[model samples]
Target chain A: MDRSCVSSRRAFLAALAVAPLSFLVQPDKAWAADGQPITKPIPSTGEPLPVVGMGTWISFNVGGDPVARDARTDVLRAFFAAGGGMIDSSPMYGTAEAVVGSCLARLDRPEGLFSATKVWTSSTAEGLEQIATSERLWGLQRLDLLQVHNLLNWQGHLQTLSAMKADGTVRTIGVTTSHGRRHAELAQILETQPIDFVQLTYNIADRDVEARLLPLAAERGIAVIANRPFQGGSLIDRVKRHPLPGWAREIDCTDWSQVLLKFIVSHPAVTCAIPATSRVDHMEQNMAAARGDMPDAALRRRMAADVAAL
Target chain B: MDLLSYSLVDLIPFSRETYFRLFERYNIGVWPAPIIGLAMGLTALFTARRADGWVLRAPFLLTAACWIWVGWVFQIHWYAPLSWPGIYFGMGFVLQGVLMAVVLGWGPILGSPEATDRNHGPGLWILLFALALQPLLGLLSGRPWYGLEVFGSAPDPTALATLGLLLMIRHPLRWLLSIIPLAWCLISGATLWVLSVPTWPVMPLAVVLYLGVIVWPWVSGRSQLE
Candidate 1:
């Protein structure tokens, strides 16, 4: 090989080596107006986690496309840049977990990244393999949180997750379900099983969880991660069609996305709300929810009713 | 996990953009496909009224070509990598195509006297819709007109037009022929539903309409099956 090409290659490797170290030394610049993110604690461990996180379902499933990967890199960068953490992915989301890993690996500072992915298959052996595969994909030696996706074989996976947690391989273990599904069973597992987190669908429009799951999680001291925070986009899309209600400024929400997101995260039981977005602008807007004082109970109800009216 | 109520779009191996990009790429790479699809659609339309034994086979031949094209190009080539289920969908499309060819070309099902056109009413309109309306929908939905998922170059149009042709044929194997396409309508519809695309309800409505057409003859005491 030519000397110039060899030197360039060495420079690239050197930059890669220095990137993580640079990020580690630098203080997190993702501060909000108060110079700190509004955070909620992990109910079980008392570990403080930023309430706004990123979800990679359809958003990060871009496969082997360089342009798409570059775009997602910006999205991840924005997520971290805005004091985001607890990125949740699953093997079921096609290439999402791998894409997230790739993005984080290339990033300057993914230190705040609280890696969470799921074990999605049927058999315990397959679930174990999937969990290991997720760790490898994300390049994490110890996963912060791992869950049974959609509660598929939760009985088996829960035992496996607990075992992994005991071994210190996984820092936290939990179960996830969305779209108002399997709540009864999920509740049963949460009550019967000793898990750290329970992820479910909770948005302004979909408050079915508020009655049972959220209360149950709070009562049980299990952390709650809210998915489908905007009713999978329709809610935000609807809210965006109209001007933001003047009352939105009362809680310091600049846009409708923040208003909707803030409503979910403000719930006493919600540990975090992971809204999936493919664009950097959306990530910026989403993470902005972490800033600003959240709506109080009456304001939250008003926000819900106002959005519902739309 | 709200598994039961979840959007089918998640089951799709690729993103909505990637799925549509298949059309964008196919339209650009294979310019001849749309032209061929037009010609084939015209041929089916012209042959729709024919009762002659050999001439009646044209629509079935067109349907088979459409099924095969959509199977290979849309499903196998573009969609398979996105998810494992995509491979099954591709295989299903291919099998449906082969089945159509076998039935029309050979014995047991749509053979000899069975391959006859009766009411071309719904079929003609449906074929025309497949050829014309589908692309219009695609264009209205923000996909460029040039990148329209034309019949034979696309799965939705191919499946829609196939249902139209099968409706006219009045064969015992008609429903059998309709199975995969009907299923595709539901699957694609659900995919659209989850993606929050405006056209999500269109496929399910089409399926219901086609089912109504298929069952009309029996319900009216025309008794083709009897």
Candidate 2:
């Protein structure tokens, strides 16, 4: 079997979801890239975040000059204009938080920003110190949500965050695990802790989370933020060859990326799916995922069955 | 999920002054290890003779997280006051400078302890010397080298030499140093495309450069270096 073929299939299936917005956003920067309303209310706060969030995780972490800084700022402006609310970053992402803060400083801060980030390191004290660093770098008076990055120092950080949330230093606290490495442990943390959010690897190709993590999060009332939404560009590699299917028009995905994002968001339990894109064009394409009528349950199941076939 | 429009192709240059702005800040020190790491891994994939092999393949992906962590911690060394462990002798001066760069640009040589000596060209030695001397200067000054950092700059000859090697590197050495810029440009280009609105005319230049890296050595009639 050609595994890359499956990648292509997954890519095509993923693209099926975003076909329509290309009609609007593809031609020029004038079309808004973001502006979709929330698909799920925060179970803890019941506040609806625009399903589209800016992921500065790796995209904005470059530096050495103003070009680096200004480009990031423009993307941030587009994100705000397009109705994006969540901005997820981490100290692990290098200069992202600082750059993101600098960009936001230039913009009129968007309303309902669920500013989220993670503390990633092994030591509890170190993690605490890093979280402080993250806040200072991002220029946050208060973080809307904070998570133990990738379960690093999760238990120790949980205690620290729980206390901070209690004292109002942070608005909410959660734990995260990506790369699909720490699922068993992450599952335990979600089962045990009162975390408001849980970040993990989930995409059309990665449905392992669906088996247990998704069901658990919905049951526990914990929100899920899917990272590696494009599987770090692997998903795109898969779809480059396959054109959108003739049947794909029913769902409206012009490009392969929108289709992938829509499929993930179509899930009943997903709170939000955070995908990082450096290109303003990609950002507009991704934000369009929020506006349309997502596939119903039956379609989602069909979408899944077809991709898994390969 | 939010829909973002645009890819690397559509860029609008902010201004000419924007070009000069590159030197105004002390930023080369800041590296996005994830993207850099991804580039490193992908390059390794392109270089590898084999396409499918799990024996060592997954480790390449896993290294992304490790390199990123090291990148994060390295920031503390380069940006913070050099102290115990460092600040203790207070260590963390120019000499510890090696640690600062080590955490960030350690590259393909990472975890392969055997390759360390080979990766060091005539240039790396100068960097090592500067790394050792900077801290001594800091100690003599009674301040952390990073604390009293003038330009947040390093004047290491070795690093300069290595960089010089990069301007025209080929063969095994080219293979090694090329990863640095390859990772740097992609990460920076992606950042620019995603974050800022710039008239970036560099992608085509980048593609050309990438092609040059692959074709130049062969076409130079120096493929014999292989």
Candidate 1: stretches off by over 4 Å? A1-36, A64-67, A139-142, A238-250, A296-310, B1-19, B26-62, B80-88, B108-111, B116-122, B168-170, B193-226
Report the C-alpha lDDT of model 1 over B1-226, residue by residue, as the tens digit.
4345545555764566865665676676767887887788778778767877666777677768778887887777766655656777888998998999888745553444655637777777887888778778876678877767777777888888888877777676777888999999998898877666787788888899898877776789785433
Tens digits of per-residue lDDT for model 1, A1-310: 0011123234334434543222121111212344345566676676657789989877887766667889999999888887787899988887788788889989953777888999988788899888888889898888999999888888899899999999999999999987888889998987889998999999999999988888788778788899999877878887899999988887677888898888998787787899999888888888888776667677788988888898
Off by over 4 Å in 2: A1-36, A308-310, B1-226
Model 2: fraction of the reference interface contacts it also forms: 0.08
What DockQ does candidate 2 have relative to the true complex? 0.06
Per-model DockQ? 0.29, 0.06
Among residues 3 or more apart in sequence or in different chains, the pairs in candidate 1 whose N, CA or C atoms overlap within 3 Å are A177-B1, A178-B2, A181-B2, B13-B82
Q: How close to the true structure is residue A190 of candidate 1, measured as C-alpha lDDT?
A: 79
Candidate 2 docking quality: incorrect, acceptable, medium or high: incorrect
Which lDDT tens digits does candidate 2 get at residues A28-89? 11112223443445666655555567676556755434676777777776776677788998
* Candidate 2 interface RMS: 12.9
lDDT of 1: 0.78
- Which candidate ranks first by DockQ, i.e. highest? 1
